[model samples]
Every structure is written in C-alpha cells, then in structure tokens.
Target: MMIEAAAKMAQWLRLEDGFTLIAHTSPDGDTIGSSLAMFYILTCMGKRVQVVCEHIVPYLYSFLPYAEAFNTPDTAEKSYKNAIAIDCADKNRMGKAVGIYNASMLTGSIDHHKTNTAYGDYVLHDENASATGELVFHLWQHLGVAVEKSKTALDIACSLFTAISTDTGNFSYCNATPGSFRAAAALVEYGIDIAEINRLVYRTLPIGKTRLIGYVLSSMRLYNDARIGAAILLWEDFLRFGAIPEDVEGIIDYIRDVDSIEIAMILRQTQKGDFKVSMRSKRYADVSAIAGRFGGGGHLRAAGCTMQGQPEAILEQLLQVSTDALGQ
Candidate 1:
C-alpha cells in the first residue's frame, strides 16, 4: 500500500509541472528535510518546483542544502498546478502556505504522524515510519531516482540524516526502530559528516540560548510527586536573553530528565500573545492525546498545542491533564 502511494505520488510529479511543496509551520528537521528532498527530486526530474514554509528555517538547520531556497508565502508564486505537503499532519498546520496548497489543482500529503487525518487528494501516511524522511527516501527509490547518480545525493543524504536523527533524538528515542537504524546507515554510506552534524544540532548553542536554559532550569517546577515537571518562558524571558523561538527548542527535554517524572511541559508565550505548550512524556503517558484536547496533536510521547492564556493558568490546566493521564 505504501509503495502504491509512492508510485501514485511519483506519477503526479511526472504528470504535472509548476509544483509547490509546503513544510509545516515552525518547520522542524523532518519537515524541512522532506520538503527539500522532494524539491531536489522534482527539480532533477525537470519539473518546476518551489518550497515554502511559514517560518524561517531555524538557525540550527541553516547548514542544510537549499535551506535558503525555501521561500515564504509572500515570495512564492501564487499559483501552482500541483502541491505536496510534507510532514504536515493537517491543512491548518501548513500555516500561510495553505493558500498556495489549496489553490493547487492536484494536492497530496506524505507524513509519518499517527494522528494525521489524511488531508489531501492523495495521502501516504505511515505512523510506523520513524520520520517522514524515511518515507521520502523510499519514495525516491520507488521513483527510480538513484541517489548515487543524482548530483544532489549529498544534499539528500544530509537532509534525511538530519530528519531521522533529530526526530529520533539522535537515535536514542524509542521511535528509533530497526528501520530508523537501517535508514541512517544507508544515509551514512553517502559519507555525510555525522560528527559535524551532531555538533551543529546537539552541541552548538548560542550564549543567549544558554542563558535562557539557565532561566528555565531555575524556574522549573515539579508537581504530582515529581511525576510532572513544568516550566514557563514568558515574553520577557525571550527579551531578557535576546532569545528566539528556536532557542527554546530542547528545554523541555531537561524537564523530562527529572527522576521519576512521567511528563514534562513548557509554556512559551508567542509574539502573538498566545502560549505554545510543548509536552513530553518519559513513558506510558500519551502526551499527544493531551495536546489534542487543546487543538494540537503529535506523537505519543511528544506533542504540543497553542492557546491564549496566562502562563499560570495554562500550566495549571496542563498539569491537571498530565497527572490525570498518569493516574496520579
């Protein structure tokens, strides 16, 4: 069935021109990588392809191939005959790019999220595929796009490596299955600089982000006998350290590290005065279901939602849910 979907997507790409590919809002490694992989593949096939994301590619991902090539909604062409949304679970998650996606005559989506609602004319969703990059890799194979022969093979390798590595927590997360390892091994055969990529993603951090982490650690609170940990990053927190949204990317992991904590959460105040809540669970708990209650969804252990509320109130509500999920 997956192969059939890939073949269908390949057919669409072959049958159409003027294609536009979209990544999710606040684009992450998987989304950006999948989008770029498709961009390179389509471009190689002599198709006119454009990639767009609602937010800037975070500084950490600037090293990716064609990272700068992704246009914003304002810069992308208004009309496209074909569209493919990569790693985005729903249409609304396409953010500003929804206009372009919806305008396209033929639309499809390729994703690896379990919660995906199959939103497209053609949808290929595999909850078991570790990362969307894995699916994209297979799609490229099904299309007979030889990585070794393609000029953009290195770029494809780097993008897929970043996508799978980051999404699986550097191969440490439970989602890192045998297939993830196989995919990573294949990408490694392309001779990607694994150490450098790790340094860029896991080790490199700006002073501002360091300070922000300190602030968050200093203020983090534990609840339900340390079964739940919560932190709040107010707008002032960003201003104080000259931090950006990307700076808060991995802070929730620290909360998850607390001994015996089943759930961790971070509430960050967005520029729009709304709070973006990131949730993580060390085990058993289904954070995605918790996030869905607030109109958000993601993987079981990791999920997020955005709501308008004071930090305290939001934290209270999330803690209630987290504890209840843990049966504590």
Candidate 2:
C-alpha cells in the first residue's frame, strides 16, 4: 500500500511545479535528508523547488550537499503550486512552514512513523520503513530519476545516506532493516564519503556540547528502582555552555544505554518556558503514548512532547505516566 501511494504521489509530483518541501521543526537527519533529496530531484527536473524548515540546519549537518539551500519559512515566496511534507507525521510538525503547506493548492506527506496521524491530501507512510530516506529512495526510482544517469544523484545519495544512517543510529538501532542496508549500499555506490559523513555527524561535536552532556549526565536521576532514568537541562544550562538546542540532540542515548534502564528521558527548557521532553525505551515501554498525552508523538522507542510547567512539576507528571506504563 505504501509503495502504491509513493508511485501515485510521484506521478502527481512529476506534473507539479513551484513546490515547497517542508521539513519538521527542530529537524533531524531524516527530515533534512529526505527533504533535500526531493529538492535535488525536482530541481534537476527543472521544477522550481524550495525547502523550508522552522530552524536552521544544525551545524552537524552543514556538510550535507546543499545544506545551505534550506530556507526559513519567512524567506520563502508567498505561493506555491504544491507543498510536500517529508518525514513529518502531522501538520503541526510542519511548524512555521504550516503556512506554506496551508497556502499551497495541493498538499502531500511522506513519512515512516507508526504514530503518524495520516494527515494530508496525499499520504504515504511505511511503519516498517527504516527511515523516510528509504521510502524516498523508492520514490526517486518511481519518478524515473535514474541514479546512474542523473548528475544530481550524488547529492541525493548523500542526503539519503545521512537520513538513514542517523535515524538508525549508524545502523545500530533495531529500526535498521535489511532494506535499509540495501538502500545504503545503493547510495554508497554513488561514491559518497561515508567516513567523512560519519566524522562530521558523530565525531565532530563542539566543546559546548561536550560540557553540556557532562552536566546533564552528572545531574541525572534514577527512578522506579532504576528502571527509568531522567535528566533535565534548564535554559541556564544551555547558557552556561553556550549551547544551542541541537547540541542536546543525542544526550538521551547515553541514558538509554545504561543497564536495567527500560526508559530514558531528557527534558530541555525552551525560551518560552515550555519543556520539550524526549523519551527513549530499551524494550517494553511505548514512549509514543506518553508523548501523545501531551499532544505530541513519535516512534514507539523514541518520542517527544512539549509542555508548559515548572521543571519539577513536569517531571513529576511524566514520572507518574511512565511509572504507570511500566506497571510499577
């Protein structure tokens, strides 16, 4: 069903022009990579395409081909013939680009999240897909953008590789499937420097990030008899390290790696005094349901939510829900 949807959407996109590709807010590798892959494909075909996201492309992804091409919604033109959302499960995730999506004559969505709301005029979702990049690879094939012949194939391959590699934790996560490895193999055949990409994304972190991670971990708390680990980074913590939100990106992974920890969570305070919580589960817990309680959601193992409250109070609320989920 997802393949059929992708084929139909590819046909529609082939006939469309003046497209705006929207990525989700606080965009991750999957969102940025998938969106850029579509941008390159459409641009190579002589279609006018603009990629928009609420936040700047993080410095970690700056090395991606055409990373600088991403535009803030405010800088985009007022109108587009069509809008396609990549890697976003819900319309709200479009963030500021929701305006562009709403203004377009037609709208579509492509995503791999199992918790997706199926919101959009044309929606293609594959819960089993390792990453949205995996689906985008098939979409490109359907659109007849022959990887071997297209001049832009390298850029598309790099973007897709970043999307797949990061979302799967460098293929270490359980989400990494046989299809993912196969897609990655195809992308590597395009001559992307895998080592360089890995260096830039994982090994090259700013000193601020190092300090921030140390602080976050040092102050972490264990709950429910060590079944859950939680950490919070206040705005002051970011200020101290001179770190941005992106710097906190993978901090929860460290917590999740601890033995006997079934669930791990990290909360960061936003400028608006709201808390953005990211949750990860090793096996049993469904963090998506916890996130959905606050009108946010993502995959079962990883999910997030935004809420307004004092830090301690929010932690208490989250702990209660998490404890209940763990049947503790």
Candidate 3:
C-alpha cells in the first residue's frame, strides 16, 4: 500500500521541476531521515529538491546524506511546485516552515502518527508504521524507485535505521512489525555501522545534558506509591545546567522503567513560557488520549502536549489525568 502511494507521489512529483521537503522543528532522526531520504531520491532523479526545517540540523544528525542541502523557510526559494511535510502530524509542529506549506501549489504529508490532521492534499499516514522512514522506504518502492543497495549509500540506510531503531525503542516497542524488521534487515545489508549510530544517539551525552538529567532525577515525584514518576524542567533548570530544550529529550524513558512505575511524564518550559508535556506508559495507560485532552496527541504509550502556566501546574494536571485514566 505504501509502495503504491509513494510511486503515485513520485509520479506526481516527477511531473514537476522544483519542490521542497519540509520537516518539523527540533527534528528527530525520523524527521531528518524521512525528509533527507526523499530529497536524495528526488535529487537522484534529476529533480531540484531542497529539504527545509525550522532549525538547522543537530550536530548528531549532521552526518546524514545531504545535510547541507536543507534550507530554512526564510532562505527557501519562492513558489515551489509542491511541499512535502515528513514525520509531522500537525502544521504547527512545522514551526517557521509552516508558511511555506501554506503557500505551496500543493502540499503533501507523509507520517506515521495516529493524531495526524490529514492536512495536505496528499495524506499518507500509517499509524502502525514504526517511523516515517519505513513509510518512505515503502513509498520508494511504490514510486518504482528501487533502492540501490551499496556500501557507499549506506548513509541513507543508516538514516532509516536510526529512525526505526529510535522510534521502536530498538525494536522492542509494539510498533515493531515484520515489515519494520524487513526494512531494518535491508538497511543492515548496506553494511552501515549500527553500533556507532547507537552510541552517538544514546550514549554520547554532553556534561550539561548529564547535569540536566541529574536535576530531573533529583526533582522526580511519584503519584501513586512510586507507580507514576513525574519530572518537571522549567526554563530555570535549563539555565542552571547550561542545557537546552533538546537535552531533556530522553529523560522520561528512564522514569518509565522504574520497577513499580506504569507511567511517566516530563514537563519542559517552551519559549512562550508555556509548558510542553511529554508522557510515556509502560503498558495500557493510553497516554495519547491523556495528551489529547490538553491539545497534544501521539501514540497510546507515548504522547505529549503543550500547556499554559507553570510546569508544576501542568505536571499536576497531567498526573491527575493520567492517574484518573489509569484507574479507569
């Protein structure tokens, strides 16, 4: 199904000469990987393809293929034939690039989020796919573009691998399916260094990040006899640790694994003084539904929302809601 869809999209895209692929702000491996893969494939076909996102590529993901080719909306050329949004469910998540999408001749969205808005003229969303990269891989086949397996092009494979591995919790999450593994196997066949990618993404945290984690762990609170741990990181905490928003990325996963804990929440302060809440569940907590009540959405086990007011209040609301949901 995805192959057919990608092939259809490729056919439509090939009919045009100029286009742009846009990703959401603070991109993860899936966002970067899917956008870059599409960019590489389109560029390979002699099409003028540019990748754009709100922020510059992170240091860790700069190694992706054609990282230098990504543009900001401010610098992107005018009047693209189409704009492809990858790995993002909603346009607001596109941040600065949202305007480009609004102005495009055509807009297409490719994502794996259940909460997707179906925003584009062409919407390819699969709630079950491990990552948007997997959907892109399938889309390539549908577009009739065969992935040329080679050691030199392993960078593409590595990008896809990282996307899937991260999104699926290294294939342990429920989203990991047979199709997901097939894609992983194909990526591994390219002879990419999975171990190195893992180390870079998961192991090599800066000192400031470590200190930030220390602060988070120290400030953790439990909602039901240690069964639910919540950690709040205000703007002040980031300043104290010399950290940034991205440094708080994976801390909730640590709390989710505590022996008795079934749910965990991480609250961070955004630039607007509002709080961004991320929630994770060990099993059956329906965090997505919980996030939805607050205008955020994601998977059943992993979801998030951005809220107004102090982090403490946001934490209190989320904990109360999650606790109530768990009780039901």
Candidate 4:
C-alpha cells in the first residue's frame, strides 16, 4: 500500500520537471533532514527540487548534506512544479510554502507524526515510524529506488538518522522501538558519526538560550497539587532576555519530570499577542487529543496548541482540558 502511494507520487513527479518540498513552519532536525533528504533524492533523479521553509537552517545543523541547496518561496516562486510537504501534520504548518502548495499542480505529503490530519493529495503518514526519514526510507525500499550504500554517499541515510534520532528524543522515547533501532543501526552502517551527532545535538545551545531558560526555571509553577508542573513566559520575559522562538524548545521536558506529574504545560506569549502552548505527559495521558481540540497536534507524549488571548486565560482553559485528559 505504501509502495502504491510512492509510485503514484513518482508518476506525478514525472509530469513536471521541478518540485518544492515544504517542511513544517518552524523546522526542527526531523523536518530539516526529511526535506533535505527528499530534495537530494529528487535532484539526483534529475527532478529539480527546492526546499522551502520560513527560517534558515540553524547554524549547528548547517553541516547536513545538501544544506546549501535550499530555496525560499521568494526564490522559487515562478519556477517550481509539484509540492511535497514533509514532517508537517497539517497544511497551515507549511508556513511560507502553504500558498505555493495551494497553487501547485500536484501535492504530496510525507510524515510520521501520529496526529497527522492527512491533508495532502498523496499522503504517506505512519504514526509508528520514529521519524519522517524512516517513512522515506521504507517508501524508497518499496518503490525499488536504489540508493548506493557507500559510506561516501550517506546523505539520505544521515538525514534519516538525524530525523529519527531527534524526534524520538535520541531514541530514548517510548516510540523508539526495535524497528527504530534497526533503522538507526542501518544508518550507522552508512558511516554516520554517532558520537558527533550526540555532541552536536545535546551539548550545543546558544548563550542567549541559557539565560532565557534560567528565567523560566526560576519562575516555574506547580499545579494540580504539584502532580502537574506548569510555567508561563510573558513577552516581557523574552524581551528581557533576548530569547527567540527556538530558545524555548525543550522547556516542557523540565516540567514533565516532577514526581507524580501526569501532565506539564508551558505557555508563552508570542510577540504577536497570541499564546503558544507546549505540553508533555508522563504516562497514560493523550496530550495530542487535547491539542487537537485546540487546532494543534503532535506526538502522544508531547503536543502543543496556539490560542488568541492573554497567557493567563489560555492557561486556565488548557488546564481544565489537560486535567480532564489525565482522568481518561
């Protein structure tokens, strides 16, 4: 069935000379790696490929293969053909590429997020997959596309490896099963520097991010009798510390560690006055279901939603919803 989908997408690709691959709006390693891997694959097949995302690849991850080959919507506005969305659960998360996808001749989606809405014309979404890279790998295998397994040509493997490694929390999350490890080990055989990957991902953070985190930790809140940890970051907090969107990436994990905490929620006030919420769960809680109620979604253990209101009001509403989910 997956092969049939890939074959159909490949046929659609044959109708056009070029295509655009859109990662999620705010890209992480999985999104970036999946997009670049697809870009490289399509380009090698003599299909012109462009990777379009809102932000540039972060400095630390710029060393990924073919990182230099991305194009912005502004750059490829007139020339692109099909639209392929990767690591994105929904079309709105496509960000700058959303308009292009709507106007494109063909649209295909590839993702591994469990909460995916199946938005594209050709969607290959597998929640069991640790990352979109794994889906791409399986799809490639099914389609009978031959990739040289040489150490020197490990671009796709490395990309998939990074995607799996990051989305599964370095393969420590519950989603990292036997198949996940097998896929990762296969990538290692392609000569990925596993040690370097760990160092680069875990040990690297901007100085500004450190200070921003310090502020959040100092003012943390514990709710539901400390069984649920919560935190609030007003726009003023970020302004005082020079924090950006990416700096607040892993703060939810901090709250998830509280003893007996079934759920954790982090609410941050974006500069635009909208509230951005991040959530994590310890066990037996389906945070993605709650997030879906608010028009956002992610993995089972972690999810997020955005709302239009002050942080306090939004937090009150989500607390009620999250508390209800804890009982379920």
Model 4 sits at a Cα RMSD from the real structure of 4.9
Cα error of candidate 2 at position 175, Å: 1.8
TM-score of each: 0.78, 0.76, 0.76, 0.73
Q: In candidate 1, what are the lDDT values of residues 1-328, reduced to their tens digit?
A: 2878878878887888998999999999999988998898888888899999999998889999899999998999876788889998889999999999988888999999998989888888899999999998888777877558355888888888899998998999889999999988988888888999999988989998999999988988888887888888988889989998878978888889888789999999988899999999987999999999899999999999998877888888887777779965
Encode model 2's per-residue lDDT on 89-203: one tens digit a residue: 8888999889889988988998999888988878878989989999988888778875564558888999999999999999998899999999999899988889988998879
Candidate 1, residue 14: lDDT: 81
Best by TM-score: 1
Q: Cα lDDT of all candidates, in order?
A: 0.88, 0.90, 0.83, 0.80
Stretches > 4 Å off in candidate 2: 147-151, 215-249, 260-328
Q: Which residue pairs of candidate 2 clash?
A: none
Clashing pairs in 4: none
List model 4 lDDT by residue over 1-328, tens digit each.
Answer: 2667777766675566778898776678899988887776776677777888876777767878877766666776555768888988888888877888988877889988778898878888878888888887676555444567654248887787888888898999888988889888877887878888888878777877888777777777777777677888888877788778768988777678767688988888888888888889987889999899999999998899899886778878888888788784
| Clashing pairs counted in every model | 0, 0, 3, 0
1 or 4, greater by TM-score: 1
- TM-score preference between candidates 2 and 4, better one: 2
Worst 10 residues of 2 by lDDT: 142-151
